[model samples]
Target: MNETAVTAASTAPAWLAAARAHANRPTLRMRMPFVVDGEDVGSVETVVMDRIVEHLPGGHRLFFHDAAWHLQSANGNATQAMNTLAQAMRELGLNGPWRNEQLVVCNEDGKRIGMIERGLVRPLAIATCAVHLIGTAPDGRMWVQQRAFNKANNPGMWDTLMGGMVSAADSLEQALERETWEEAGLRIADLQSLRHGGHVDFQQPAEEENNAGYMRERIDWFSAVVPAHIEPANQDGEVERFELWTTAVVHDHLARGEFTPEAALLLADYFGW
Candidate 1:
């Protein structure tokens, strides 16, 4: 065997060795579609990530949540997958104890608003499972947010919207309402939650393409479309700058590394682009 093969063999865990031997091994991985109110979550992974985003909103955390059903579907590699994930995370500079922290904070009631996944539950705003709110101008441009400099994970990166973790009190609508107000000054009262969009599809990143094991859970994806021009109040604390964009602009921006690799993968999968 070659040096790399010998090295990999030396470090191979017993479980993976067993898993790999079963060539016809069926990676029994899949997630139930997540939805809220009426909207269908287009991608489960994005929605789960969005659920965990947190910002201290005048003491109110704009909590997002993942359905337990969906949560159980992803990362089912069990101990073996975990070992591989840990090794990969370490090699990729995303390892460390801090990576396991939860991104969302629940209310006093301890409701399940959202959870931190990816071994480290980073938070995000923008509802993908239920009612989604997209910011745009008169044209068909999409508005995006540049993550603040003080941000730890994606500092200097841009996103579909800026959001934070919050308590899971009140209804999902109330949470979104609270999130909109917190991330950017906007009231979504009388807003409509888009219903029914699940069985989310996955368009994995290059590395994940052959990783059939990693794609078990289907991230139900959902997006909300706001009818009017959204003028979000700049919450300097949670956001950097906001700009309206066309699909073309977003396409280029994504290509230029404006969004995090994970976010980019999700956006692509969401639109099935």
Candidate 2:
């Protein structure tokens, strides 16, 4: 092992280190790739694979080949086939909370290959995309929202100003706009100095449902300045409330683990922490 490779973590803030540790679990190494039509997409835990083999209908067709689970019959009508599989998983109690929304599934090269129920993404380890926005005031204070207690994942945790998954039917821009308006009641067009701040890739054993699934997603983060005259109101029930905090307070919250892991990582990167 390279001895010098381990010192990088010492340079990052303790909060960021904790966030990275939370987002990248060692259990991910135990999962096998989920292959579809000769394309490597997603992964499956051994336990999950076993459950599928024992409880899923037509599950016998899935076979282990080249160290991965190969689904040969999922070639045509990929979307329909994936949806059918997701529904079957739901029946077997292998899925997360169902959203009735479709999330686009992409291959290793980021090619859109299919669409599956949002709830099934974590169960199947399918990589999905989301948009997260950081709203800031001219005085360097940040706007954050508290997730509703009823949320399926990370309920009641503080998050970025606005964050949401990119549905199969919506583009990145559309998702950003929709999430911003719905979660914070702030129109994207009205924000000042809006800019995309790249993205963060996250993968970990799902903690929300007792590790019954895995989370693999790419979060596209953005930053903007909200006008002092404009106040954020929750137009959607997904948010419990919104609050603006100074930089020092935000850092303290992060250190004390008040923010969600995703938001912590994003904010850490934003502040170069």
TM-score of each: 0.43, 0.88
lDDT of each: 0.40, 0.80
lDDT of 1 by residue, 1-273 (tens): 112112223332233333223322222343333332223322233333243323111222222355421222132322232233333433444422333423332222344344333332111111222223344444445667777787655677877653433232334556556666767676665333433233332232212222212222223333444456456666547678877776667767766767754445445544443
Lowest lDDT 10-residue stretch of candidate 2: 1-10
Best candidate (score: TM-score): 2
| Tens digit of per-residue lDDT, candidate 2, span 107-220 | 989998878899888877888889999888866678999999998878899999999999999999999999899999999989988888778889888778743678888899
CA lDDT, candidate 1, residue 203: 30
Q: Which stretches of candidate 2 lie above 4 Å from their native place?
A: 1-12, 53-61
RMSD of each: 17.8, 5.8
Candidate 1 off by > 4 Å: 1-132, 190-222, 225-229
